[model samples]
Target: MSLFDTYIAVDWSGGNDRGAKPKRDAIWACAAGEEPVYLRNRQVAEDWLAARLEAEAGRRVCVGFDFPFGYPAGFAEHLTGREDALALWDWFEARIVDAPDVNNRFDIAGEINARVSGVGPFWFNGLKREVNHLPRKGLDRTNADFPEKRLVEMRAKGSFTCWQMAGAGSVGSQVMMGLPVLARLRRKYGAKVWPFEALDSAVAFVEIWPSLLAPSFPGGMIKDAAQVRAVARAMAVMDGQGSLELALAKGEGSGAEGWILGVGAEDLLEAAMKPIDMPRPPKLRDDCFALPAGVDWTPVDEALARLDAALRCVVGVEQVSHTQVVGRVVAEPVTARRSNPPAPNSAVDGYGFAHDATGEGDQVLPLLAGRAAAGGAYGGTVPHGSAIRVLTGAVLPDGVDTVVLEEDCSVTDTHVAFRGPVRPRANTRKAGEDVVAGSDVFAKGHMLRAQDAGLLAALGVDALPVFKRLRVGVLSTGDELVDPSQNAPPDRTYDANRPMLLQLAAAWNFEAVDLGHVRDDRAALKARLDEAVGQCDVILTSGGASAGDEDHVSALLREQGNLQAWRIALKPGRPLALALWQGVPVFGLPGNPVAAFVCALIFARPACLKLAGAAFAEPQGFMVPAAFEKRKKPGRREYLRARMGSDGVEVFASEGSGRISGLSWSDGMVELPDGAMDIARGDLVRYLPYGSFGL
Candidate 1:
């Protein structure tokens, strides 16, 4: 039996209307076991597809559309700070406007081209649309951010540039209108869009270059319906022979950049073609870590840069009351609702006078007719050379520009004699000095503290828009592990990594969820992950990450999601596993408690902060003298648990990662550089305190 109940091939149109019969300006759809359908517009096609998909409920349905699912990978990263092809679909869906005969595909293409450095990437505007930015000629203009063609487009001989919207053979218009339909289908049917997301899903929607398959049919058949029918029939035959599955397996591209469904079956196609050289690795890998052989292990700095580029902030914002916003990160810029002090007020309990008192000789001024106290002010302007009795924080009377402290002046009931010289506006608080009206008090991504809350409250702000706390699920997996409260056999020990990680998460202002422990059974680990993925923004687990015979976490992830990267060049923590399970990020640390602690501090903590929409955090470290001699390898960087003493920083007696007591015994850690070296006593070493990592 075929893997899917039906196979569909669609030839899309860029034109604005349902052209006359036999014209190529209408959508043509052909399904296995059914005749080809010529749809007049996008809405009609979408309604038709939705009904077909609903009729095939509980069965796998495979659909292929003729258009670029995503643009060139570099353009994607430059626009979205990510290279995932699926993200491009969302980007287009948000920007492109598709109406039956009045779409703005050409205009949007011109707008996107303007963002890049050069012109002509998106040339060839439609006849009616006058896009000033889009140039007609000079299509050879170079932009460093975008490639000339996507990988699949270059691989297929007859493919056109998705950037060209108006010219003949241009796929740009089709892409702009097609992606929104694909996004809607994905939302309604949960269809797996290939090369942008993965192909492990049941109901799959893939990108197809109809020209790649159009050559197999008889020549001189110019009808669009005949082309789609021939391609659909050919795909059904391929499905019967199990060639379709092989094609899907071979078409996997860097995530969400699309690959043609039949690129892998170039040999089977009638056209005599040489293999097109796919672009060199774009300095990024979406499916897995590029642990190429003969390459040295990644340095700590390079690893951190890669991690930052690969991750994105979790979505969604929350309205938090000012009183309860402490420890929350701001999701939007916070503006001051009102100026501090609101009006001109006295900076001290003193006498206010209208004079440049700091002149050569002290000017004796008469007392003002009224007194201005806090919560009660003197309304009228002060007479010339007259002083007003003003208390601290009271609004200063008009015409009085300076204040002289009561002690600085010899005072009497009728008048006051100023002895010390004073400058204009001295000791007078100006309106809006502390906080100007409509000024941004706090920017987005600022983590709220006690003082921040107090400042917001003073501005009369009762609520703030803050990112919701990242809920981290912590777990420990091992067959020989038991709960801390339960007794264990001599061969087994209590679970410590979970509690430590949970506490660390809480300390770092995350919502920590203890997922309990699971044995090394594959089924058991899978069950725990299924439970945690929905509740947590990210999952952290200790043990079972290594490629041991009984290790199940890595194995389960391989089956359910994807294992992106594993292992880092850092001592005390090396067997680190990074994966995605049901779209939730998972960070797997070593089983050893000490290693788990170090990894949590170095990796998981920063990852959590990013997910919570906070900025990158690098714990500050200082250089201190090495108090004890130590030897280390050359390649991987190492951290030694140590305490500061009279001489300098002292290393822990033992180097084992399982030595949990060493963490508490030492005040912080001493970092050693990569390369084989000997640390002599009194040698300078970089030191980081536990507090620096937000202990």
Candidate 2:
């Protein structure tokens, strides 16, 4: 119905046709049009693909390829040396989502590639990468060999077709092996990728990202940082990730060892090529890109660099001990400073005296008259056959333990009639009963909450020193951006981001100072940005951040700010940009209200927390049931503003991030089905929970 008449994705692979091996090797393809069909096989794969393109010629057709579109710096040597290196990526990055980077450097490609080299039982499946132990309707199960060996054999035969390149174990393995790096690179350097041949049709049709007509960063392997970044900047245009925003301006690592092709990869790859010269850098070919598998990007290495850089900047915040400060981000772990009860004290308002030793009713005894009132202690011992008079909060006199209430005791001038003697230490609050001294009450990086404040107060803490919040600046830019005082233009509309942004910033506990909106003029925008630097810690700009001719933010930013990453291969919020200006971190939020909100949730909110010096600031979304049947293509993540409906949480059918109305109809955004999983009504879907999301 739309301009994209059909979207087809092909996953073509080699079939061992000598009858000795079954052409079970698969090459998948799909076309989204009047009718969408998925094709798998070398013979049928290309003809079907060419026919669809012809039928939909002149119309935008989207396709996905599972082959190694670009290999390492020198493919011939790299492929020859490594035994089907692509097979190693079967571990988790691409297929298994949420696989955390728990250890040293969790490089999905490198890790899996290494394992596949000499393995008995491999971890996962390739074809339908989602092919777990469970059987599906369309797939015919087969014992596919390790992707690395598959590629080595294919490359040896010199018979590598696009189909073989796409569906062979190498193609399936390497493409997927390279998936995380590609995803991150798409984030690192905005790149508009051309899919090879093996993607699903409906899902492949629309440029998939966080917005409409957005392209899923066609994945590719690049060797140079400059190239990776260059591609990222360019991709920003196609995907609307983040645009450079200099006019609205303001301010401002990980794993090791494999699939690394650019810059220093030669040293390692060279050693890999020439065994004796291990660890030395390689001299890679200029034309190709490196595969990320079998590579190690040590976390320790990056963390050291980060720490080295981090320690350079003297932390602006002051750390105060729990005993000295009332509210602070606990720098050092805090142990209970003192025992809650200095000594045994009274618990009740009733009398505090040594009653009869026997269980008797109202025993008349000589009241060893002594007042151990809370502040004024009697500091004396009591003898037998006598008692001491004490108030509720009084410390018990020596030799006279426990207390009898006035109701349980009778009064006399010097003698008192009381109930039988109570148990030892009864009616008394014990020492250290509440909190033991020297035990950890709070851990390092604990954010002071309300109850924590009260506890600190009770511990005799006054004004507690806390980490100073990072100063953040917000600037909105656009030709149509007018303040409340400005008169309306014939075609201009009021900026919808400022008020909501201000409110959202405040909600994150950021000391957000609104720089107001700057007109389309570059000088004005730059001036506003310069002024903001003196007053803010980070700068945020909306609107004029795009590459459009009228948009000045991009050009201004390119002067000093490298567009590190923009345009996500997802929907809504894809146009967001993350950049650095004058060493300060700047985020370019899309002008669309809904896009801005969702992007802010993903990027801005986290950045604010990081700058706020609050480790507690986190963006963790939840999974809830979808109240309605929502359909989507594979390859791109989708964010749909959804309300916590009566059933669970129904996503608004109208999920255009550009549409402000969708935001009003939902509680928060739902991250719809990721690649491979088709979301049906009533199925639980991943989403940013209402708590983490700021309206």
- What overall lDDT goes with each candidate model? 0.76, 0.48
* TM-score computed on alpha carbons, candidate 1: 0.57
lDDT of 1 at 648: 91
Query: For model 2, how does the per-residue alpha-carbon lDDT over 1-695 read when each residue is reduced to its tens digit?
Result: 12122234343333221122222233333332111233333334445655555565444444444344333222223334532222222222345333121111213332433433332112333244442232222132232322223222232233222112222233433343334433433333232343222222322311111111112222242111112222222222111111112200111110111211111222221221111211312221221112124533222223223322322111244323222232235544655545666667777654554444545555666776557888887888877667677777777777666676666777777877755646666677777788766676777656576688556534433223355445567788877766666688878877779888877777665566888878888888777777776677667888767779877777677665665335454666555555555556667878888778776776666555545545524446777787778658775567787778778778777765667887777777777644656667678887676576534
Question: Model 1 — which ten-residue stretch has the worst lDDT?
Answer: 272-281
User: On residues 191-249, what C-alpha lDDT tens digit does candidate 1 reach at each position?
Assistant: 98776565555678977776775545544545677667666655655654456677777
Model 1's lDDT to the true fold? 0.76
After superposition, candidate 2 runs with Cα above 4 Å error:
1-315, 318-337, 351-427, 437-440, 485-487, 620-625, 661-665, 676-682, 686-689, 693-695
Give the best candidate by TM-score. 1
